[model samples]
Target: MQKHSSAIWTGSLKDGGGSLTSQSGVLSATPYTFATRFEGQNGTNPEELIGAAHAGCYAMFLSALMSGAGVVPDRIEATSTISLDPTTEGSPTVTAAHLDVTVKAPTDEAAIRDFAEKAKAGCPISKLLKAEVSLALKIA
Candidate 1:
């Protein structure tokens, strides 16, 4: 299970712009610049990509957990917000990740909470990230 993405940058660090391409071509030539990363400009940034992956991973993992317990969910909505802050060494660090999840399931409150806890701890992305991970689950 290996995925790859390539990036090409030109010019100086602050003034340089780059394109990102993934093996699946989803991000073919997707533009990123210093402004996008540091100044909240209009373009994709690394943090945003990480958030996307985390959100997607959490949603899928939750669905699987629910299904395995014979409690298939009707819907699962998840959002992952990665907290990026500067470290003492003047480098960006992922300090934390907040996952907001809403699930529409036909199950008891106890079961839903149990499944949510399991998924939050068992998600592969959660294990990969060293930062603190917090999950908020809403049942509907």
Candidate 2:
């Protein structure tokens, strides 16, 4: 059960460009550049892709967790905000990820919170990220 993605970058870092391709062609040759990553360009970036993946993965994981806990969620949405910031020594790094999650279920607040926390901990994408991650859960 191993998957892989590849990236090809040409030229220098600041002015270079790259394309990423995943095992599935759904993400083939996705373009990315310095401006797209650091600046607010209307192009794709690794961090943004990571955020999307994290959000989707967390949502699905939460759904399963809720079902396994004898609770079914009517709706589950997770947003992952990945922050890239400069380190103490001025090196750029992925500082943190803040997950904002909302769930609709016929469950107690305590159970919802517990399930949300467990989902955040058990999500594969969350496990892959080494940065600090925080979860905010809302039940309705």
Q: Considering every candidate listed, which one attains the maximal TM-score?
A: 1
Segments in model 1 whose C-alpha atoms lie over 4 Å from true places: 131-140
**Candidate 1, position 3, lDDT:** 91
* All candidates: TM-score: 0.88, 0.87
lDDT, residue 24, candidate 1: 100
- TM-score, candidate 2, is 0.87
Clashing pairs in 1: none
Whole-model lDDT, candidate 2? 0.90
Q: Tell me, what's the RMSD of every candidate?
A: 9.5, 9.4
lDDT of 1 by residue, 28-98 (tens): 99999999988888999988998898889989999999999898999999999988885546778878889
Please estimate how well model 1 matches the true structure, expressed as its whole-model Cα lDDT. 0.89
Predicted candidate 2 versus true structure: per-residue lDDT over 53-89, tens digit per residue: 9999999999999999789899998899999884547
